[model samples]
Target: MSPVFAALKERHPNLRPQFYMSDCADAFWNSWRAVFEVEGVTRLYCIWHVWRAWNAHIMKVVDDARRSQLREMLLKLTQASTPHAFYSLYNTYAEIMNSKEYMLKDQNKKPRSLANTSQKNMSSTTVANCGLVSAAWAQISLPTCT
Candidate 1:
């Protein structure tokens, strides 16, 4: 717990420790609160458990099919050897609720992801974390390689 939380509770009598937090019922809610919604600001949690809760079931059905088709590409992306190549690979949806035929139509345009790239698009800090360079942003450097 942050000192700010302790202080806020002192200021507001209604704000119980539990009120300021999500209980076992509001599971993701608590994780969200602890991370992003401090003082009403929130950031998405990037934890695997959360993802498994959200997407694991959706992806299980087509897992073998995808592995046969693009396992190698998926492997490199997982290993992060070619961070940029991830966008060109297959995306495994943890919450695959739609039919395979329906999903595949949109999959080609988006490409499969080893990551949730949409989150990065929502935050610049994420892009930098991934070491992405802008296509339009030119590089200016003096070559030093012998």
Candidate 2:
């Protein structure tokens, strides 16, 4: 991939690329992180893939009866109008996880690992770098007449 990209860059110095990929593996993300940083490329995560990962994670931790409702709320966060709103919802979710009712049901199970996975996956760096909160909504503001 690097050799191919290097050749292209040599042929077209003005050319810039945007790379979109799934969060299927940490290796995949790490491999491109350095390449994108050095080449000044925009790295975007596929929303469909993101939803797949989110759904998988939620299914493991959330109750079956409430999974559908919780999944809907999780999806809505992706459509948040602002980063603050996104984080606010995230914080609310965190608080819910810590509540007495939640703790009793959790029963010292695997919720901690679940929370860690969600936190790392939703890190500020990932959100900002992928422009999930801003670039997404910004597209709607473009004038259709233009």
Candidate 3:
């Protein structure tokens, strides 16, 4: 964030940074209003923290099959033009992968590492790069003129 701001400042020498942002939520909200009041820019947290949080549940539900499905889902469902669609797909996939059946897949089976099986090779479908979503959301967003 700082680097981007610095580059922007260098290019537009008239611009000035009003505040710094860390991951602290208190600091962000408390200072955000002041920063935007002084300059039009507001500092905030990136998707990294959100992604980390969502992935914790993903690791639990991950198996080989679900992992493949997740990768493909992210590839297909995420689009810049439709943030709603992207988020909807995420919520839907989260539901499927976190279902009772999926969650209980290992309760009865003994933990065995099979090198060539889906059980061993799969990651959860939930672990995805937020950049994909961000890029997809960058294009003219779909109208929700409601």
Candidate 4:
């Protein structure tokens, strides 16, 4: 990847990308910074990967109805076209996830609250650790790459 980036840079010294879309991989990000050297590039993670990672954790929700609801909320979040819409959906999701009705049981059947989880893990940042939806929507009106 570094060699490819180096070659591209060598071929087009003026080429600078505004946005880069990739899966949530540390190596890819590192290469993008260290090798690509595009100062203002906005890194965007694949929504599919983010959804899959969140789905894994959401599957642990004890109630099937709540689990399905959470999935729908996540889908809506990813599809949000504006920052306001994204944040509104996110707040609703957070409210429900933090509610007592959304409790998860331990191996001993003890109720466990996801409230103890870090905000980063509980929110959309769990997988990508980046504000994927909000950031992407913020740039919705930007000109597309040719």
Clashing pairs in 4: none
Report the C-alpha displacement of residue 24, candidate 2, in angstroms: 4.6
Candidates ranked by TM-score: 4, 2, 3, 1
| Per-prediction TM-score | 0.28, 0.52, 0.33, 0.63
Instruction: Indicate which candidate wins on lDDT.
Output: 4
Q: Which candidate would rank higher by TM-score, 2 or 3? A: 2
Which order, best to worst by lDDT? 4, 2, 3, 1
Model 1: per-residue lDDT, tens digit, 31-144?
535544356322232324323422442253346666443334323433343434433331332122233431232221211112233443434444332332122111211111
Which residue pairs collide in model 3, if any?
Answer: 64-122, 80-136, 80-137
TM-score head-to-head 1 vs 4, winner: 4
Q: Residue by residue across 1-146, what tens digits does model 4's lDDT show?
A: 77777777789878887556666555666776776666776566565565554565556544676677767876776555555776787667656655744434321221111111223333433323245453433322211111
Indicate which candidate wins on TM-score: 4
Cα lDDT of model 2 by residue, 1-146, tens digit: 55555565577776545444434344544654534453544444455555665566555566787677666765665555556776676566546555613223322121100111344355554545345443433322111110
User: What is the C-alpha local distance difference test score of each model?
Assistant: 0.32, 0.47, 0.39, 0.52
The C-alpha stretches of model 4 lying farther than 4 A from their native spots are 100-146
In terms of TM-score, how similar is model 2 to the real structure?
0.52
